[model samples]
Target: MTVLQSFPIPRPTTNPYLIMLGEALRRTPGVTVLNFSWKTALFGRYDVYHSHWPEILVGGRTPLRRLTRQALALMILIRLRLTRRPIVRTVHNVERPDGLTARESALLDVIDRQTTMRIRLNSTTRLPDGERFKTIPHGHYRDWFARYEPQEMQDGQIGYVGLIRRYKGVEGLVSAFRETEGRREGLTLRLGGNPSTSQLAASVASLADGDRRIELHLAYLSDAELVEIVTSSELVVLPYRFMHNSGGALAALSLNRPVLVPDNEVNRKLSDEVGSGWVHLFDGELTAESIITALDAAAVRADRPDLSARDWDRAGIEHADVYRAAIDAGHRR
Candidate 1:
């Protein structure tokens, strides 16, 4: 059987899910994983059509192109349905980060009604309730990121690394860092990553201006730069207003570095399940006082969560089982 994944295949990516899952899927017998595109999907030759982040399937700038992609998606759906193939969806986010348009909303409606199998990367994901939902934990970045010997932390350097977004509480982190600088001594806050927009970058830049206590690398960081940013930190702070899952937190843990995350079920669970005094928590209002308290409470540990539970080989077997079941479901239909 063949499965077409709705993500860039055979392409180098920092995303651990693709790197690890792709590695494992390649090893799975009788399963062919192919790169997906509207053109390739038009051929209608796959047993299973799997997609993560459905928005990407219909991503476009012009309304005409968007509509065209939507029509293509419908055609693919129709072909799959008529061929009795399984259509699987992985709900990576509760809603699109950039919100949705009328066409995007309609696309999701059809997909929700037609999808034969749904994989929830997190059980608490905000997708609509359905019997089609299948819970699967996200794969870890430990292997792909190449676990390296952690260097000694210098001057309580706290860091945040990943795509800088508006809702990610970058502003709040900056404010808290400034407040911390006022109270704490000899500490620096380093933020590295390309911002969501040049405007947002400018806003953050203005806020960070004249502050020697904070350092910003507002660009797409290379692997070596990412390593330095993560390993040199005493603690990695991800003060997201909310979250479903975070590869950033997992990456920090893989490096045996403690992480301070917002107090939510997903983050708290990561702390409880895979912690060696590394996960620190802060509740609503990530104020400087609260941030300092969590930072002070955090302690470096020799032990960390063994991320082997997220290995792709085991996940691949489970995925294969799901595919076989989906294929059977198709046969029944």
Candidate 2:
């Protein structure tokens, strides 16, 4: 059997789901993998064409460019339809186009009409055209966790990772870290990721100049550096104001490190379903006092066993099943 997997290039972060999907397909006997571009012409030879990307509707200026691209994509879909080869789309996120113009809405309608199946990461997302959709959670890069070495505790050391965006609640984390800085012995806050130095400094500038516990690594981090930072810390805090599903949180969970997330409904549901006692949810407002209390609790339970084994394998097997089902459905049609 032949399978063509199409993905977008030039993304800053490596997508672990694509990696896992490729690996799982390779492991299946009698299956051949093909990586192709979005504009590639389809010969009538391939058995399946599986596309992975967030569902996007073209908007903004350059309607000509958009039409050209859409024409090529439509040609590929027509080929699949003619050959009866199943076209499966993995929906990472079906983002509404910025400004939500009429043209964008129409383009989305076109895509909904063309695609056959959608695999959703979160179960909450609505289906396209009321068609069949499968829910598969994201997986972790298990190999990256092997390089991590636990760091010696320095009392109140706290760490946060990932892109330091406004919605990420970095300000909350900093305020919480500062609240316990002098009150606890050896209290330190370490911030790492690809945020601009000026932006990061501006966020935490209110802290005293002499505060030694705060360390910031405001640059793109390699896998080794990320693993080291996550493993060494007593607790990894995700204080997200909103989370659909967190890839970073899963990465830390794979390393058996405890994570402190806000007590949102989503986090609460995941914690209960996964039996992950390590995920602590904050109550009341996400004030410095509330976050500090959660962090202290997380510090005590940092050594908890990793709860990732089941979820990781389950996500992998679920994708494998989706691939097989797509293949079978195509053959039947």
Candidate 3:
């Protein structure tokens, strides 16, 4: 069984989740893995198509590029339907991406309708009516970063790393850290990752201005740099306005560091899965008190988060099972 992945294999800048999943799928018994390209997507031979971040297919930097990709996306959808190929889409985001054009939305609707199965990275994900789905915990990054030399963990160092976007609430994090008082003399906030826009970059910069305790690396972070950010921090805070399944949180845990995230059902469930004192949460809006409180909580935890459920080998087997089932059902349909 050949499974076509929507993303390419591991690269210096590839998302670690995709790289790990791709490697695991390749090792799975009776399964062959193929990385996606426009050519392979439209005309390649594969038994099951597994798509992650399908929106990327229709997104582009400019209007002309977007239009071209949207056309190809339409053609791909038509071919999949005509050939009766099954699509296994990973539900990475809870909703249709914000700021999508109407045509992109319609094309995504087609992809949703044609999907045979959806993979949820966490058990707490809620799908629309009548959508068939499976829960495959996003794999940990312990093995992925094993090659890098571990950075010495620093006390009172809180870090946030990954692509910085407005919805991620980086500015809020900076504000909270700035206002936090008492026992924070040793606390330093580290922010890393490229911003989505110049305005966002400036917003975070303005908030972080004159705060020597706050460090910003507003550029694409390589794997080694990411490892240093995660490993060195006593706690990693991801104050996203909306966070369902975060690779950042998992990466922090994989590196044996605790994390502070938004309080929600998904995060609550994650806390239970990982263990006590490993995943702390802040409710409502992120504030100075929440940041300080979560930091205090992370300081006392000495045990590692339990990530046995997220082993890449297990993820590979589970993905292969889903792919096989989707293929069988596709044939029947």
| lDDT winner | 3
TM for candidate 3 is 0.95
Give the alpha carbon lDDT tens digit for every residue of 61-134 in model 2.
Answer: 57787676566666676687777777777776546435655654665566566566778776666664668778
Q: Evaluate model 1: give its TM-score.
A: 0.93
TM-score of each: 0.93, 0.80, 0.95
Clashes counted in candidate 3 amount to 0
Write candidate 3's Cα lDDT for 16-98 as tens digits: 78888888988889989999888998989988888888889899999999999999988988888888899999988888778
Candidate 1 overall lDDT versus native: 0.78
Of 1 and 3, the candidate ranking higher by TM-score = 3
In order of lDDT, best first, we have 3, 1, 2
Please give the range of 10 consecutive residues that has the lowest summed lDDT in model 3: 294-303
**lDDT by residue (tens digit), candidate 1, 141-258:** 6766675555677657888998999878888899888887658888898899999899999998989999998999999887667778988887888889887778888878877678
Alpha-carbon local distance difference test for all models: 0.78, 0.65, 0.89
Model 2 stretches with alpha carbons more than 4 Å out = 8-13, 38-45, 55-68, 97-105, 122-129, 148-154, 196-211, 273-276, 283-285, 299-316, 328-333
Query: In the order shown, what is each candidate's alpha-carbon RMSD?
Result: 2.0, 3.8, 1.6
Which one wins by lDDT: 1 or 2? 1
